[model samples]
Target: MKMSEAFATTIAGVAPVILLVAAVEIGNRKEALREGYHLIGQRQRLIDELYAAPEAPTGLQLQAVAAQTDQPMQSATRDLFIALYVMSALIVGVLLLLAESLALVWLAGSQRGSHPLQAAFCLLALVIGFAWVMLAPMLGLVVAVADDAVVVISGVSRLRRFYRDLDTHDRQQQAADGEQT
Candidate 1:
């Protein structure tokens, strides 16, 4: 078979696996985002409880907050997300191994001794091709599933900001109370 024909056939054979892995990764991201939103809602509720009274919350509210924080991470939903990440990572690893083997075979069969520069160029091209194929699909899947978390993956920073704002407000209130007294 011609070189181009072989390349086309090999890619055709691999495309389905790559597509399937990408779909799984996208689904994982979606579910993870859903779970994250649920956890954030729980956290917001806890925060509301803490701010409900003029005085500090009692031990019961603190226990409820701790439970809410731990529930999401400890649940089966998180296990499924972790499993998807592992499976997708394994699929990507297999694809990389296959690409590396193909590159090695192509290098061995081609007349590399005759033109060292051409051989080097071919190796570089193979690396670039592997990177494109390996990363592009995953990147596209990530972008598609990003939703509101496109700029911030974990969203921990947003929570931190909220907490900081609350602290500042509380400090100001304390200062006002002291001044009034």
Candidate 2:
């Protein structure tokens, strides 16, 4: 078979998978954005509560703030979801571009009936696909690690602020109660 025909066949086989991967990546990004917004809303609500109370909230109000904070903290825990989506989109684009380049090379290399080169092209395509599959988990791991680091830093900051606010609120409450008594 001619190299052009083989290259076309290879592309035909690979394009669907590339497109599918891209689609999945886009979906993940959308989900991440959705969750991010949800967390942002929760955080905003906490800020609202902190502002709305006439005096420092006590007991149940404090508990409510703590409960609301949990959702944002939990949602922010993973950085990988966003990173994976970006990486997957990038990988898919690279793969598609590489496939086109390979097809061009195959067309240029073909001279008369050269089935061996076509076989080699097919093998390379398989190898590339397999390599991507193997590399995906590693990419995910990198994203997850980076995300964890950010979460740790942010969580600490948030906790510090929370504790400070709670302490101040407790002091104010004690003063108010003493005055009332």
For all predicted structures, in order, the TM-scores are 0.37, 0.45
Worst 10 residues of 2 by lDDT: 76-85
Residues 1-181, candidate 1: write the lDDT tens digits: 2234345345445544554655665565666566666776777777887889899888987887777676554444443544555565565555544554554555456543344443344344444445655775566456445533543555788889889999999999999999999
- What clash count does candidate 2 reach? 0
The list of candidate 2 runs beyond 4 A from truth reads 1-8, 48-62, 101-181
Poorly placed runs, candidate 1 (over 4 Å):
1-3, 73-181
> What is each predicted model's overall lDDT from 0 to 1?
0.57, 0.66
Report the backbone clash tally of model 1.
0
- Candidate No. with top lDDT: 2
lDDT by residue (tens digit), candidate 2, 1-181: 3455656566656756765665665675676667776777878888786879789777887777888786576556454455555665676556665665666565556453555665465556555655655565466567667767777998899999999999999999999999999
In model 2, state the lDDT of residue 111. Answer: 57
lDDT of 2 at 37: 69
